[model samples]
Target: MIEEIQEQVAYYNARSQEYDEWFYRIGRYDRGLELNQCWFNEVDVLKSALQDIGEVNSILELACGTGIWTQELLKIGKEITALDASSEMIAINRKKLNDTKIVSYHQVDLFSWQPSKQYDLVFFSFWLSHVPPTQVDDFLAKVYRAVRPSGRVFIIDSCFEPSSTAKDHFFENENEIHQRRKLNNGQEYQIFKIYYQPNVLIDKLTQVGFQASVKQTNNYFIYAEGKKINKL
Candidate 1:
């Protein structure tokens, strides 16, 4: 599993240039690279996850592709450590947020890297879905450790409904995911085949000692927030 993830990372790194161009070109529309806000959930969902955070002195955005959510962190006046596995993605993000003082960018694997300091808010936007099911436990453990006492980890990613009759409801199979990809963006990039199962993720978070729950967003993404159990 580790090797598979590493291979996927290498592939993404190699195609970083192409991906950069592709997204930048798409920036012309609301969904484009001009900013990654459109890909995010509605303002209300973002607000809900952030409401209790009040103000953060420092925040960590793991696997922060192109730093879209990192920008949102900045709006709330939090200094951000935007970490990505692909150096090319970090480079593209840096190009967009040229101010280095506020946004400290790092290119490192989330599975192995350990933070020297805890953050008030640790966020992974549309990232958990990419992680393989077998490795999710370890991933959740790391996320649990990165956050400060009473701080929370916010995950917003793809989720499917079990009995939704909607046409583009939740993905139950590869075909549905492919259809979603085509509908959202005409790209068929499935570097690593992944699927989202909401209840399963919540259960894993519980096992890792987090207080977890899920929120259905925009009838598309699943937003889960987990709070690290702090020692009093």
Candidate 2:
């Protein structure tokens, strides 16, 4: 599993340059203007949801790839600690933020990294699904430790939507945790990809000592917000 996680990091490092193309609906990820509109609409729903949580004094973002959510965090957070396994991704993120001083970037494998400090808010987007099933509890525990008392967590991820991928990609099986992903250059990598049902995830978070609520958009995304209610 560690080897698989390392490979996943390498894949993201290699994919960093073209990562925004998927988010911006360009090149291979352009499904159509209609689908693109739906994507952004769902993204807006997520943004609004995040805003509803009120302001955060400090935020810690895990797997802050390409700074998509990092940019959003800056609007509401006074300071942010962004962490990712790929230095290339952090480099692109730093470039996009124009070298913001308020945000500090750390390149470390999340599986082995421990938080030396806590924050009022913890955010991770499209990242939880990448966690292997065997490590979900440990990962959530790490997230729990990263949050200060009375702090909250917000997470966004995919919802098993077929249209969520590039036009050339296909979901080979419905019941698998490992998925094959391809880059525009015809490079391929196997990465952990697990789609969780909202209720199941809510229960899991609750079991891990979070007061959690998970909801889905009209399509394309599922988001959850939870407050730390007690120590795990």
Candidate 3:
């Protein structure tokens, strides 16, 4: 497990250059124009949901990646602190932002990460799937502590749809917690990937003191929002 986690970090670091292509439905990730359009349409839905949560004064983003979500977050967050395990990912994110007046970057492993201070909103995109199944409880506990009471925790992750990945990759077995992913250059890596049903994620959040709700977009993505409400 330790070795696999390290490999996952290395995989993201190596794939950082082409990561945007995956999100944009370019290269091997394209599944024809209709499917590509559907992907973008759902992406808009996720973006809208993030924006609809309203503006926040302090925001913390985990596994922020190449600023795809960071750009949207900039509009709503008064101040932002972004964290990622890969320095390469952070480098791409910094370059894409082009300016950093409202943001700061930290390269840290999420598995062993601790929040120095809480925030009004904690957001992570396509990161929940990378949490190992055995470590999810501990990870959610960290998130529960990362947000202030009544603060929100929003998450975005991929569904089990095989088409969500590159055309050359084989995705199967929803019950499996591991996935083999191939980069554009044809290098492959085994990473932790656990797909969750809406109810399962909701229950996971609830276990750590969050009032949670989850939604799945057709066959592409699952997005969720949770609030940490103090119990009377």
Candidate 4:
């Protein structure tokens, strides 16, 4: 399991250059006119949800990949702490943001990384799904501690829709938690790719003492909002 996790990191490091293609719906991810449009429409929904949260003084972004969502978080966060396991991904994020003084970049595996301080908001996009099932409780527990009292934690992750991924990648049974992802060069790597229903995610959040709600956009994305329960 540890070795496969390392492979997952290597895959992302190698894929850093082409990672935007998936978000842009270019290359193998292009699914023709209607489906591609639908994908963008749902993406817009997620964007609006983030904007609706308004602004915060500090934010912590986990698995901050390639600055795709970091750019969005920038609009609402005055100070952002971005962390990722892949140095290559962090490099791209820094370059894309032009090493903005408002953002602090750190390269660390999510499982091993600890929060040095809490923040007004905790955000991650397309990240929760990558967490293995066994580690999810521990993962969300980390998210819980990363937020301040009544602070918000927002999540954006993928649904199990086939069209949401590259055409070359195949979806296994819904019950399975692993998937094989292929880079453009035809190199494939196995990684934990767990999909979640809205209710299930909400339950997970609530179990960790968050007052949470989750919603989905048709067949593409599941986004969630949770507030750390104020015990004080």
How close is every model to the real structure, measured as TM-score? 0.73, 0.97, 0.98, 0.97
lDDT of 1 by residue, 115-225 (tens): 778888888876676676666788888888888887888887654533222223344664232222212333332344455667876888888878988776654467788
Candidate 4 lowest-lDDT run of ten: 169-178
lDDT of 3 by residue, 1-232 (tens): 8999999998999999999999998899989999999999999999999999998999999999999999999999999999999999999999999968898999998999988899999999889899988899999989989999889999999999988888998876988999888987789899998899999999999999999999999889999999998866
Please give the range of 10 consecutive residues that has the lowest summed lDDT in model 2: 166-175
lDDT agreement of model 2 with the native:
0.90
RMSD in angstroms between candidate 1 and the native structure over all alpha carbons: 5.9
lDDT of 4 by residue, 64-106 (tens): 9999999999999999999999999999999999999999998
In terms of lDDT, model 1 sits at 0.66
Clashing pairs in 3: none
TM-score of 1: 0.73
